[model samples]
Target: MPDGTVPQSVLEIRRDLAAAYRLIALEGMDDGIYTHISARLPDGPNGEKRFLLNPFGLRFDEVTAANLVTVDETGAVIDDPYGAGVNAAGFTIHSAVHMARHDAVCVLHTHTVAGVAVSSVKEGILPLNQWSAQFFDRIAFHDYEGIALNLEERERIVADLGNRFVMMLRNHGTLVLGRSVAEAFKLAINLERSCKAQVAALGMGLTPVVLSDDVAEHTARQYQSAYDAMELGNQSDPEWAALLRRLDAVAPDYLG
Candidate 1:
């Protein structure tokens, strides 16, 4: 609330989360005017329960800490510099996730070419290769509706998401929810990679080298650990650091 140095911890989390979104954009995961990312404000000793998200019209690569909007649990914009407010439609999608999923601190959605392509497949994500191995038996699929603008649809969305971190919105796109921004980003990255590889394999008409059930199970277990994102203060994740630098090079004004 003050203009002085932001608390080191909060500043770091904000930067990391913003950086992740920009990287998503950089990696060609954003669909024209769709997709979004959200982070639940950390619960402090006093039990504060706010959250941070992007303004509806801003490009992901153009997002920054100062531009991020803080909103209450009810989806009311608390302090929005752009005065654009939260994407109510996006809120409907994300709030249902945040409310039902207590551990879901960050939610990232994408509508990449590969993601939508894979979502359209009846089989969903297969154990095509190692890239696809991460989601071996872990992908959830949701039937396509026209748009995600109805609050009433929240129940269905939750039911569709179930207990999985990666969800494919049939004929729509993909989503990854996690306990932290870094965790969510990692999941989204993997999901996109899996989809891309699957699309490539499909293009080549080559049968995918499916993984054994045992190995797929083992890989999923290894990916289940909660990410240590608190140490992101120094960009502990090289990938994240490199992503921020990439964004800086391409869209430096996003740091506004």
Candidate 2:
């Protein structure tokens, strides 16, 4: 390939990832310059993998397609036009899943208020609503291991994630991954809302009506099947499309 030329496919991934950042900001899931979203670039013919990650210190609202940086599997910045760098902790978490799960091409992480509150609970992601049910028995829980800057934590992250698409970082935040930026966005947003619902219910300080085990499992299967079809069909999620359209109206520069 040319020295400075980027593949058109990677350009598309850049746009998708940038759009996700802006949407995360718009949806109140972003935590200033912290918490990052990343998308995997296509592997080279020699089997080298690369990724697109948001630059550290740049708020999600400030992200644009052309501003995203390229990084290697080792989390080294390869093509950072702005030299803003990526969050070291972000690299640790995102790279673990990106390397461990080929199907998880896009990873979304958030440090929302509700997410952190529920992360401390021993019972994680209860089936308080249909949204919560979608993650029933499918959410991984990784004990908060301090700041996550330690390189050794990567193995533990991958081990805890263990084929799960959603996870709670005990006393920390949340992590979600998917085959596409759109799918990851959908999962992250729902998980956020579900966390909100749980927090709200618990705050009521009354006996909450939780779903039965059978119904929770059945509900989870329903959502899993729907997402499975979306992934297997190689189609964009409807909600993602609609959100992109909405973003176009408010933040069209995401595609730049």
Candidate 3:
């Protein structure tokens, strides 16, 4: 808050984000300790933006609310009690979105097999089914720029992302954004499911019938309407609540 102290609100964010890490690991969407997920903290006392990110060597399942490092806008860790500082490249990717998209409070990036499979293809997120339809034309693609260690790449990442909620990092992985950790977790899971389904369908060797443009657009609109309601506070996400219940039952240590 005023000094180096993290307010209770930020602690709640850390709890939710740690839960997300555990859930991702549970869902088989994590890649060791490589990929990263980040949540933007409320403006600090000096009004400078801060972020919460996983430390460099912790597996997704190893993350805990108490261990997430807090970093400033320059991607420098400001508070790392465990001395496990944030990953520089991870910060490079996440900071781009956090700084560019103010409303996207939670940004999740993954390097799952299915996600990378979809990202490698020229056409990203085809509408082969209902789950896929949700992101039919709603996904953005950013060409892989080496290891994202360079700060200059942040601008290009922002430009490529535009206003899309989902981004497939070409030949790399998937990135999803949400207004909250719950929403971000939901979107990431759905995107991963869609990618897995797409890979399975493509392996069948049959020319899978793709959804028609009209149908895909209509289905996307349906998904968008639900997102609108959720974003506008008209309704709460039952799935997010249920997932959190499941996480608490299975991995309550995330709250630490």
TM-score: model 1 vs. ground truth: 0.86
The C-alpha lDDT values of all candidates are 0.76, 0.85, 0.86
Worst 10 residues of 1 by lDDT: 1-10
Measured against the true structure, the TM-scores of the candidates, in listed sequence, are: 0.86, 0.93, 0.94
Model 1, stretches more than 4 Å misplaced? 1-8, 43-48, 225-236, 245-253
lDDT of 2 by residue, 63-82 (tens): 99998988888788888976
CA lDDT, candidate 2, residue 47? 79
RMSD of each: 5.2, 4.8, 4.3
Give one digit per residue, the lDDT tens place, for model 1 in 1-256.
Answer: 0012123366666786788778788787876556788887766457756678888888877788778888766678877987888776677788788878876768888888888898998988888666677777788778988888877887898998888778999999998986567668878888888888888887897766778999887776655532433323323557656777876798776666
- Which candidate wins on lDDT? 3
**Model 1 clash pairs?**
none
Please give the lDDT score for candidate 2.
0.85
Pairs in steric clash, model 2: none
Give the top-scoring candidate (TM-score).
3
lDDT tens string, model 3, 12-116?
Answer: 789889989999999999988888889988898989889999988999999999999999877798899779787877788788888888778789999999999
For candidate 3, give the lDDT of residue 240: 75
- Where is model 2 more than 4 Å wrong at Cα? 1-8, 234-236
